[model samples]
Target: MNKITIFHNPRCGKSRETLKLIQEKVSDDDIEVVKYLEDVPSEEELKNILTMLGVKAGELVRKNEKIWKDNFKGKDFSEDGLIKVMVENPKLIERPIVIKDGKAVIGRPPEQVYSIL
Candidate 1:
């Protein structure tokens, strides 16, 4: 099997749910949880992962976050601007992103992690 990485946040319901679903479909030892908030990805790494996800930087952002609401809600920025924000504030990155092989997916329903498994 390919390497499986879950960009997880323990406090996030979706992330927790995604992990549970992955456990059902894959072995526990095969699943690697990257607690992204604590250990944010490098800019280059994030860029490649975004390409794998087929989404722009802003699309992967948690715009509903209080920090976003307070500071970034009204701004209309280009892709670079959004990427900078996520780099500066890891909380801006959304939860439960599952990466397998060379493909990446957001586990919005949690079960989505199984699709690429």
Candidate 2:
């Protein structure tokens, strides 16, 4: 089995649900939970995740977050600039990103992670 890692934000209900679903579907030892707020992903890590997710840096952002609204909304950013912003402000990262076997999915509906597994 492939190793699984979830970038989880416990405060978000969707993130929690994704975590629970992973727990139910995957062995405890195979899954690793990263409390992203406390342990933020570096710029390089975020870049790798974006590649795995097959998405642009902007696509991985949570534009609804106040940080994005107040700081980045309506602003045009280069791909690297967006990645740098997300790295600097983890709150702008979409929740419950599950990574497995070099593929990644945003667990917005939570079930999305199943495909990557």
Candidate 3:
């Protein structure tokens, strides 16, 4: 199996569930759990992930986050700007993004991770 990478936030229920599901499907050594909040992705990494997910930078944002709503909501941002925002404020990034090979999926439903796996 290809190595799987999960951009995980342990505090989020969906993220935890997705990680658990990935754990069951993948070997321990093949699973790469990235606690994205503590170790944020760089701009270039985030852009690559967005490409793999077939989403724009803004589409990957968790718009409901307090940090986003207070600081960035209702504002216009270019693609690069949004990527910068997500890189700087990883909490605003969506939870449990699973990537394998060259594809990625946002695990909003936890089951969504299976698609890329």
True-structure RMSD, every candidate: 1.0, 0.9, 0.9
Lowest lDDT 10-mer window, candidate 1? Answer: 78-87
lDDT tens string, model 3, 1-117? Answer: 778999998889999999999889888899988999888899999999999999998789889989998999999999999999999898889888999999999998999988877
Looking at model 3, report the run of 10 residues with the lowest lDDT sum. Answer: 108-117
Please write out the lDDT profile of model 2 over residues 2-110, one tens digit for every residue: 7799999989999999989889988999998999889999989999999999999988889888888898999999999998898899998998899998999999899
lDDT of 3 at 92: 89
**In model 3, what are the clashing residue pairs, if there are any?**
none
Q: What is the C-alpha lDDT of each candidate?
A: 0.90, 0.91, 0.91
Q: Mind sharing the TM-score for model 2?
A: 0.95
**Considering lDDT, which of the candidate structures 1 and 3 is the better prediction for this target?**
3
TM-score of each: 0.94, 0.95, 0.96
